[model samples]
Target: MTGVPASAAGGTGRTVPRGKLGTAAVNQASLWNIANILTMVRLVLVPAFVVLLLQDGGHDPVWRAWAWAAFAVAMITDVFDGHLARAYNLVTDFGKIADPIADKAIMAAGLICLSSLGDLPWWVTGVILFRELGITLMRFWVIRHGVIPASRGGKMKTLAQGTAVGMYVLVLTGPLATFRFWVMTVAVVLTVVTGLDYVRQAVVLRRRGLAAERADAAAKAGQRA
Candidate 1:
């Protein structure tokens, strides 16, 4: 009927509870959001990239370059997804949790593969992978208290690693071999610096008792309320 609200309609033309449609709309919005979808896409690409890298044909310089290019694209998606989420106010808990995991997995797998192929030094990969895993575990440990936001140094570390790995792959070409080594060396230095910075931040947080202090303050305010 012309008088019926848009949310209500049926064969019998009966009116439904208005709140149901509103809740459904909210649920649908939450489920199909851009940020969460991008996170899932990133996670899916990790395994595909790994498979491509592991295949025997992947040893060819051309194939390796393509694989690395695919990886770089995936990594770029990681950057853009976060930027879009924050810039457009599309952030979600799903994104926050999955994005870092996807990043660590992709980078770790790539490094491991490169190491196995004897293309990169194991020690360098080991140091970076260990730091990534350690920080990820720390995030889980502190997640109950609150999120530790990504620091500027941490972001720079990611950029450095990506650039280094990309250059390393490009260096597979005979002409660029020496340049790749230098790029990788720079990346390794950045990785160590950023890792230490994260450790320092954790120590500062503990010393200030920021999370506990905030919790206590919240409780006291609640009591007063």
Candidate 2:
């Protein structure tokens, strides 16, 4: 999942001055704000998408179209929720956590359903899911050290994956099917390459963070002595 945009204040939120008294009012964003609501909606769509995709034994073009619609809505929300959260300063803890989950949930559901239906290869799903989940865990592993900022290549990977999956969700044939194969190939390549880059960054960040901590502790001991 792409990183949510940083807030206007270079933080998650900000206080705005308001009213005739010109008092500062903290815009305490609630968990139920528009952005978070969109994320929750995407979560709900995951099951609905699966049902639509697998209906009629998972081969009906009309059913697949419906499933694609659900998938499209989920992706559209994925785009807007982050934008809305950043633009309106509606970022919240629930949003921060739920947004990425919503992104991966819908995409995973799409990929798995397609694979289960024998449309896409299971290995493709495995590679993409492994990279996405691994990077997520790696982020947490080094979170105390520092955030691994999203790179251009990482954004490209997300785009490639989304486009490839969306194409697979549709019941395309002939030339279109051939084209999507190549698209998915590109997506898989990006997934593996970017995942390796993230691992390298996590190692460097953790080492640096640990060294800084040690230096601080040594200085504190000297001060006490």
Write down the TM-score of every candidate.
0.79, 0.86
lDDT of 1 by residue, 118-203 (tens): 88899989999888888777766665545678888788788878877766654356657777777778777878887777776676
> For residues 31-81, could you state the per-residue lDDT of candidate 2 as single tens digits?
768998999999999999999999999999999999999988998898899
Worst 10-residue lDDT window, candidate 1: 1-10
* Candidate topping lDDT: 2
CA error at residue 100 for candidate 1, angstroms: 1.0
Per-residue lDDT, model 1, residue 120, is 87
Total backbone clashes of model 1? 0
Tell me the TM-score of model 2.
Answer: 0.86
Residue 77 Cα positional deviation in candidate 2, in Å, after optimal superposition: 0.9
Candidate 2 stretches greater than 4 Å from native: 1-29
Give the residue spans of candidate 1 off by over 4 A: 1-24, 144-146, 210-225
**Which pairs clash in the backbone of model 2?**
none
